[model samples]
Target chain A: MSDPAAVPPLLDARNIACQRGGRMIFAGVTLTIGAGQSLLVRGPNGAGKSSLLRVLGGLIPCLHGTIDRHAPIALADEHLALDPDNRLEQALAFWARMDGVDRERLDFALHHFRLRELADIPVRMLSTGQRKRAILARTMASGARLWLLDEPGNGLDAASLRGLGDAMAAHLAAGGGIIAASHFDLSHQFGTVVELDRR
Target chain B: MTRWFLPLVRRDLRLAWQGGGLWMPVVFLLLVASLYPFAVGPDARLLAATGGGMLWIAALLAALLPVERLIAPDRDSGIFDQLLMRGISDEMIALVKLIAHWLGFGPPLMLALLPAAALLKLDGAAIMRLELGLLIGTPALAALGVLTASLVAGLRGAGALAGLLILPLAVPILIFGAGSLHPGSGAALKFLSAISLLLVAITPIAAGAALRAGRE
Candidate 1:
């Protein structure tokens, strides 16, 4: 784990406003998270939770706001994001190559998420929980400082949920930041929750 | 700009080969050429006279075949979103995809032209002119195919719209490429090359902007 004191904060958002499909979703939001910190975005369905993550990920622009980040970020939404037809290992390996993740770290990330055994299977074969873990492994493998997860605990069983929790703890211990949007109560681990509403 | 550019191309080529119906365009080109003789009643002289222009039209239509699925699948599946999060620009992704698309369809279309020419009863000189015109023109077709796909990929009825969008952009290439078949028409070939180069230059930028807009 990297030392939090030595590492800079991973993300900052000030006076943020977001819109989707020509309507405003959230406005006047502000937050900052540094290394080893987590920001939990809590919102009900259609409350723009996913849209906020997309905006922060820079896939869409924020209507009125500013965000600053000191390091690269990773995102794992409901979508697998990996190539569906390719073997899971091959698909993850492609991102690993692009992300410059070393062999040792990649192997460790796979092991951490219990995906090492399913690595050779095609992504289309994985069950819902397994696919979720695989996507998490991809984010972990990148070794990015900030992780924007739309729903980190959607299809996981009890064991996998605990596994995800442990992984987030470990990531924070290693000076990474997390901004997760979930209806589930993960505030104990995340420590700071920002609630959104339907409007 | 990452070391992933080559790997990206390789992956796309494989997808185009295995999942993308890579041979469909070439097959369509052949089918269109084959229909020509039957429609014109198999008069060798008549087929010979009209064959080269018909082939050019077939090639233009063939270029449109791959447009519907070109960018829509990857864009819908979150691949581009993932790539964007990793700091890869849409421009780079579009450029690599353009190259891969050309490699997948361009050479195969040219190769199939030989048998198609024979089917049309084209003479050696006509075949050579057709081949030269295709060689210079297909890259532009490939570019236009991708550029249209990017623009229409996120829209409803993208497939139907893509055909309508690409036909107009392809008119210039068709005029020059088919025109080059006439004797003493070297100027047409140069014009075809200029049009092709312009298309090649503009597609990446336009497609990149389209991709970014589509995400919203």
Candidate 2:
């Protein structure tokens, strides 16, 4: 890992607070994740883990906070965000094109996630676990510097879960950062852990 | 913007075609135009005098057929959020959607007008004028459709609300487009294009704001 003092943090959020439907969800939250580091967020049901990830991804605004994002981010949430009518390869390629990554990177992402065999199938035809794998493959293919994953382990089988762990390890080793909100044990070490509880 | 613009437009156009319901608007426009002559007992002179305006009304209503599908599906499926994350502005998305929506429905409606004109007993001159009026007016109607769609995207029963929001705002386009069908009404066509231009220009900003407001 690189020296923390030498490089600026990839994400620097301070005094963050969020609310939904006129009620405070979480507040006074602060965290930082630098290159080659990770942050794992955990909370019970309705505890705002997903909301925090959304806020961090810039999908929703924080009620009170300052977020300084120094690099591009890829987000994987419950919504697959892929075109259902498109083949898995085409769906992922759309994002790859939008992200300006070359075809080689997309091929590597597909191979990394073991999605090569399922590339020709329509996205809607994938099973629950395969769908989760596809979503992860999209994140990997984005070539983003930071990844924000929400409940990424929901439907993955043991092997797929292991693949996810390996992918996360590779991402961090290559100077990418991660902030994941998950209930299942991801089997990866996180440099910082944040626990959010409902008030 | 250039990097993703063409790809987004192409993706949307492919989906619009692949979705397979584009024929609904074209069929609906023809149905309404065909039914008009039946409702008014066939009188060639009467048909010629009023057929062009009736077609304009049918075209306006035809534009509404595709409104519900314009923004709701993409927004619900999180496509908008994903696009926004890619640094594509809400205005650009709205603009692309407007273009895609128009391309999907505009030309087909024009083609269907041919058979509908034959049914209405319209002369060759009136047919040409009506065609020209619709060519300029459909873009504005499409803008209205997309604008209302964005405003009511997340609401329950958005179709009904879309009609309510669009018909009132569409009066200007309708008046100019229909008025242009009258004899020697030279300025009406210019007015029609001006309104169409204004609507097309403002739709992106208005609809973009609505999309942002829906997020909250």
What interface root-mean-square deviation (Å) does model 2 yield? 1.4
Per-residue CA lDDT of candidate 2, range B43-65, in tens? 98898788888889889988998
Q: Over the stretch B1-216, how does candidate 1's per-residue lDDT look in tens digits?
A: 648899899988898888755798789889988888888889999999899999999888888877877898888878888888888899988899899988888889899999999999998999999999999999999999989999998899999999988999899999999999988899999999999999999999999999988786
In order of listing, the candidates' clash counts read 0, 0
> What lDDT score is found at residue A194 in candidate 1?
94
TM-score of 2: 0.96
TM-score of each: 0.95, 0.96
Q: Which candidate tops DockQ? A: 1
Residue-level lDDT tens digits of model 2 in A61-119: 89998999999999888888889988999999999999999999999989987899999
List the DockQ of the predictions in order.
0.79, 0.68
Off by over 4 Å in 2: A1-6
